[model samples]
Target: MKKRSGAGLRARVGAIFVILAATVAVVDGCNGQNSIVGGACVTGYVACADQCVNTAVDPANCGSCDVVCPSGVACLDGLCGGPVDGSSDGSALGDGSSGDGSAGDGSFGDGGDGGCEPPFNRSSACGACDVVCVAPNSACLADPSGNFVCAPPCTPPLVECENACVDTQTDPLNCGVCGKFCPSNLCANGVCQGATPGDVVVLGHDYSSGAAGSSQAKVLTNAVFIPPSNPLRVLSYEQFADAAAVARVKSLVQSAAFGRTVVFTPSTTSADLASPTLAQSYDVVLVYDQQGGAPANLTTIGASWVTSLSDFAKAGGVIVALDGAAGQGGMPQLLTSAGLLAVGGHQTIPAGTPVAVVAPADRIGAVVASPYGVYNRSVSLQAVEPEGPNVIYVAKQLVNGTPANPVVVHKIVNP
Candidate 1:
C-alpha cells in the first residue's frame, strides 16, 4: 500500500468516478427503463422526439409498449382515454371492480356470489334494475344457470257465479242475481203467475214486461160479474196489497165456474203513473187497500194522480179506492176534486146491517152507535164531489141549525 500525495489522490478519485458511471450505464441497459428498487418497467413511456408518451396508451400501439387503444378510446396524458359523461359511441366498460353483494356500488349482477344471477326478484325483470319478476299469466321456469324466466304461462279460466247466488229466474226485483237465468215458468216474487187469456185481457195486447195492471189482471179474474166467456179487461196500478188479500183474490178466482181462465201476469214492477195507456185502458181503476201508498221511489198522489183522476172522473170513469187509498188524507182531496163530500173521523154503522139503502126511495142510511153500543144522536155522511143534480138517499142531521148534516150522503151522479 503506497501512500500518495494530493495530486495523485485527485487522479485516483476521478478514475473511480469513471468506473462507477460505466457500471451504472451497464445496469440501466440490462434492466431496460426500470427503477433500481423493483423490476417494473418504470412507466415504459417513450420520449419520441419531444412528447413523453406511452405507446400502449397511444392510438398507435397498446398493451405492450408498442400497443395502443383502438379507434374509440384515445390516448391522453400518457394513458388510454378516460370515461366520458355522455359519449355517443355506445360501448360497455368498467372503471374498477370494488363491490360487495346487492349493496355494492357496481351494477345489479356485477360482483356477488357467481355474479349474483340466481334468486331472481319479481320486481326487477324485463330489463328492470334492482327487481325481477314474471308478468301475470306467465309461467316461471328455471334456466340452465338457475335463473328464473319471466313470461305468462297460460290463459286463466273464465269467472262464473256459483252456489247460493240469488236466482234471477223468479225474483222480480233481482232476476238471476248471478249467472245465466232464463225466464223460467213466468215466476214473480218466487210465485208463478201463468199467463192466460185473462192475463191478455187484463194486461192488454200492448202490454210488455213490468206492466202496471199485472195485479188487476188477477183481480178482474176474480170479479163475480166478469164472465169467463167475456172477462172484464182492466189495467190498474197498485203500490202494494196485503199478502192475505192477494191470497183471497187468488182463492176467489180458483172457486169460480171457470177453472182459471184469466191468469195474473207474471211480473209487475213499479208502476209508472205517467203512462196514459195505464189510465185509459181500464174500465174501473181501483187502487184498493194499498199500504205504503207513497212509495219510496214515487211522490204521493198529491198533484198528478189527483189531477189525472179528476179528469178521469169527469170523463165518466169509475175510480174506486179502498182503505189507505180512500183514507182521510187521500180520499178527501180526491172526492173534493171530483166534487164530493167525505166525513168520518169516528163513525161506524151497526156491526151487522150498518150500511143500507132505504127501499123504494133510493136513499142511503147508516146508523152509527158508540163503542158502548149507545147510538150517538149525530151521524156522519160524506158527499163526494163532481157535484151535479144528485139525490140524497139517506142522511142524519149533524148541526141542529141546518137541515141537519147528512150522516149518509149518497149522490146519484148522472142518475
Candidate 2:
C-alpha cells in the first residue's frame, strides 16, 4: 500500500516475473504429456482417450497399439484393421475383363451376347432374341395386322406363303408374277381358280363333233378330280366297278408321284380290292377310302376283305372310312374289326347351309383363280360321316371354285 524505494520496487517486480515463468512451464509440461511427438499420436506412447488417432506410423504403437495400425496402412476413421489390397487388376471373375460377355458371369448374372439374332445362331438371323422369338423372317412382308408372311417369289415352288416365301398364286396383286401384286379381286395360288363362264381356256378344241359342243372339258396337267363311288349297286353291295372310275384312279396315279385314294367298297372281294392294289402299285397310297355308303347289307363284306384292308394300311397305306361304312358297320365297330385303334373317327360337321369355301394352298388342290366369288360366299359340304379330316375348298358360287367348309375328312386310325 505504501510507495517503496526504486531498488525495492525493482526486486519485487523481478520476483513476480519469475513466478509467472514457473507457472507457464508447469502448464506446458502437463499439455506435453497428453500431446504426440512427431506423428506417433497413439495410446501407450503419447495420446488421450475420447479423441481421434492414427495408429499407423505410430512408433509407440507399431502394428495396432490401442486401435492404431502400422505405418504401411492408413488409419481409416479410428480403426487399425489391416492393409488394403488395391490390386483388383484383371483377376476377378465377373469384371468384364475376360472380353467375352457382359460384366457378369452366368452364375451370378446375365450371360452370352444377350440375343439370338444374326451372327449369334447358325440358323435364322432375325429369329429369337434374348431367348424369345423375335423378328422372324426378315425377308417376309408383314401384314398391317403384324402378321409376317412370305413376300413375293416364293422359293422352291409349291411352298405355301410363309415367313420365307410369298404365295403369288392367290395374290390378286401378284398373280403369276414374283412379287407382282394382282389387280383387285384376282385369286391366285400355284394356279388360278374360280373362272367365270368361258373363263377357262382349253389347249385344243374339237369342232368336228357337230352335236358334241366342245366335246371336251378343261384339263389340268397337274390336277385331277377325286370322285366318290357311284351311288348305285344297292343289291350286290359292291361298289360300282365302272371303267371310268378305274381309269380316273389310274390317271391320278400317273400324274402325282404321291397319291391318296379313298375307294368305297360295298362288298369286299378279291375282285373289289384289285383296283386298290393297282392304285398302290404305282404311287405311295396316302389313303384308301373303303367306307361305302349305306349298304343294303352291312354285314356281308367277307372278313377277308377287312383283314386285307387293315394289313395294307398297317404297311403304310392310308385307310380312310366313313362313320359306319368301313367294316360292315359304324366307325367304332369297323375300327375294332380292322385290328386297329380307332384314333379318330366319325364326327360330322352338322349340315349347315353353304356359307363359303376354303381351298388348300398346296399346288395339287383347288385355289383362288379370280376374285369374282371369293369372299363370304355361302356354301356347305354335306358331311354324312363327321369323324374324319374335315377339309373343304372355297368355291360356293361356281362349280369351278371350292366350297368353304371341309368337304373331305381323312380320319387317321391311332393304332
Candidate 3:
C-alpha cells in the first residue's frame, strides 16, 4: 500500500476503529441480544431470550428471568416459593449453585465446620459443629482404631482411661483405677481385693395389682430391674384399674425416686397416700394412673390428697406423674395450670415404632438410658404457655417422625 498524506491516513484509521468497535459489540452481546455478561445486561434485570427483564417481582420471570414459578408456590419480591411479604432484602439461592447446596467459601472437609473441627472429632465437635459431645454417661474419646467419637463410659464401676472403656472394678490389668495392676485374680468394687458381696436393692412395681387377690407381681419382678437411686425414696403410687398404667409403673419404679420411697403403696385407697407424714418423709412422689381419676374419697382422706401432693410439690418434693396421669383429673389440671406440665392428652404410637426422646443438657439422659425407645402408648399433652418464665422444659416433644406435642417437663414452684 502507498503512503497517504497525514490527514487522509488519520481519517481512514478513525473510520476503521469505529467499524471494529461496532463489530466487537455485536460479537460479545450474545448474538446481538441482551446477555448476562458485559454492559448489555444491567443489575436488577436478568437476561432471558434476547431481553433484559426485571425478575425481582415478576410472576412469569421469578427469581431468574426464565423461571416461570408454579401457581401453587408464590414468586415474592425476587424470591421463589416464598410469601409475598411486600419486602425484598433477603439473599436467595441462585441458579449458579454448587451441587452441595453451600454457596459461600467451601473448604471444610465432608460435612465439617469451616476449618474448625472434623466431623467425627468429639472433643471439638461431633457429627457437625452444632452437634457436640453429650450426656453424662457419654464422653468424647478415641476408640480402639484411634478415631475420635462420642461413647458411653463402661457400666457403672467401669471408667474411660487410656483410650478405652475399662471395667476398673474387675480388670486385673487395670484394677481399681486404670493401669493399677492387681497382684491377685480378684478385682472388686474397682479396688484390688475389695470385693464385698452385698444385697443389690433393685426395686420396681406394676401399677395395676389385678383382681382383689390376684397379682402381676411376679411379672413385674421378673422383668428387667430399673436401678434405684438411694437416699431419695420414690413413692411408686398406682391405681388398681389400668393394665397400661400398671405396666408403666413397672418402668417408673426403676426411677431414682423409687430408691427413696419411704413407703410402697399401689392401692388407690392406701392411707399412706393421704398421710401428711408421707409428704414430709419422702423426697419424691411417682403417681401412676389408669382411669385418670382417684379412688372414691381418696383425694379427701383426712386432707385433700390433691392439696397434699400440690403442697408437697410446692415444698420442693418432686412429683412425677406417670402414664395416663396427664389425663387424670384435678391433680393434672393443677400441674398444667401451674405450668409444670403440658395439659392432658394421650397418643398411642404404632407398635415397635421408636419415639425420639429429646433430652436436654441435664442428668435426664443418664436416668433414661436410650435417646430413642418404643413406647406403645405415650402421654401426649398439648403445651400451655406458662404464667411466668420459671418453667423448665426438659423435652419439647416425643415423635416417631413428626413431633406431636410436649411430653416431659419440670418446674420448681415459688411461694
Candidate 4:
C-alpha cells in the first residue's frame, strides 16, 4: 500500500467513525423483533432471554435471572419473601399495612398490636406485647370487669400455691397459708398437729344440780382441755338468742380462771364462714342461736359457707353449737346438709329435768357430772333419735325415774 494524503486519510476515518456510531445505536436499542441486537443492559438491570430486566425487584427474575418468587411472596433487595412496600407491581403478598394479614408490621393474624398475632390475648403475649403469663395454675383470662388479666386457674376454696391448686386447710406443705410448711407434716384444721391428745367442748344446754345454777366451770374444766403448748383460737358467731349467754361464754373463756389461752374473735355476720382461708384461721367455730331461738338459715348462709364449715370440721376443727343452734334451720341442718350427721334434729326438754350419764367410759361421759340437772330452757336431739357408729349418747333425761330421752349427745367425727 502507498502512503495516502492527509485530507484523503481524514475523510476515510470520519466515514468509519459514523459507521461505528450507527452500530452502537443498533446494540443499545431494542430490535423490531423485540430482542437486543447485542448484550447491552442498563446499570441496575440484567439481560435475560433477549430482554433487559431489573432482577433486584422483579419477582420472575429475583436475585438472579429466572429466579421467580412464590405467588404470595415479594422480591426485595434481590431476596424473595420480603415485606411488601405497596410500590411493588401488585404481585406480592399482603397490603403492606399494619393489619390485613401482612408481614410488614408483624400482623399475621387478627392483629391487635404489632409483633403479636391472634389479638395478643394469648398466655405467651397476654394483654400487651411481650407480657408472658406464668404457667401451671395461672392463665390469661378476662376478669369480671371485662379486662384481661393474669389470674390463678383455681376455684374459690382452692388457692394457687407452687403452681398448683391446693387446699390450705389440709395440705401439710401449705397449711393455713402458702409456703407455710409443717415440720411434722400433720396439718389438721389448718394447724400443725402435735402429739398431745385433743378434746371437743360442748357449750350447749345448761348443766345444773338443784340451786347450783349453770355448772359452766365444771363442764369447761372437764370437756374443754387445751394443752399449754397449743392455745385454743375460737371464732364465735355472736348471734345468740340471749346476749347474756354470749357474755357468759366470753367472760368464762377470757377470764384467767379458764386456765388456757383462748383467742376469741366475735363477728355478727357469717362472711368469714364462706372463706376457707378465713375459717381455717381458728381452731374452733361456735355457732350460737339467733334472737328467735332458731339458728341462722343455711339457705341464707349460702352453699359455699356450708361447705367451708363442713371442711373445717372434717379437717379437725371443733364446732360448739348452743341451745337453739340445732333447731329447724341451725347447725343440725348444716350438719345434715354437709353429710357430717346422717340424722340430726332437735326437741325441747322440760326444765329441772334429771339427766344421767349413760356411757361412763366415753370422753363426754367421763367429764359430764352424773345426775345432771337442767336449769334454763334446754333442747335435745333425743326425739329425732340421732344414730350412727360415731354417735355417743353421753347422758339422757330421766322422766319419772326412768331414762326417757338423750339429753347430752356427742358425735365423734374422725378427720
Backbone clashes per model, in order? 38, 51, 10, 0
Q: Which segments of candidate 2 are over 4 A away from where they belong?
A: 1-239, 255-268, 271-294, 297-299, 302-304, 319-406
TM-score of predicted structure 1:
0.29
Candidate 4 lowest-lDDT run of ten: 86-95
**Each model's C-alpha lDDT?**
0.32, 0.29, 0.41, 0.52
lDDT of 3 by residue, 293-316 (tens): 553332333243655655555544
TM-score of each: 0.29, 0.24, 0.35, 0.46
Cα RMSD, each candidate: 31.8, 32.4, 23.9, 26.1
lDDT of 4 by residue, 1-415 (tens): 6777897555444533432332232223222122222123334446677555545445677778899888744454456744333222211221233333222222112222232233535555454433445644147677687645556567768888756889988887777766554556888777766432223333336322123223323444334433222346677777434566667656655553345566677877768766675434766676555434333465355344666766666655666655442225365554454443433566666666677777778755665567776656565553343545667666677778877666555666555
Which of 1 and 3 is ahead in lDDT?
A: 3
Considering every candidate listed, which one attains the maximal lDDT? 4
Ranking by TM-score: 4, 3, 1, 2
Q: Which stretches of candidate 4 lie over 4 Å from their true place?
A: 1-217, 220-229, 254-258, 293-299, 302-304, 325-335, 338-345, 383-385
Looking at model 4, residue 279 earns an lDDT score of 34
TM-score of 4: 0.46
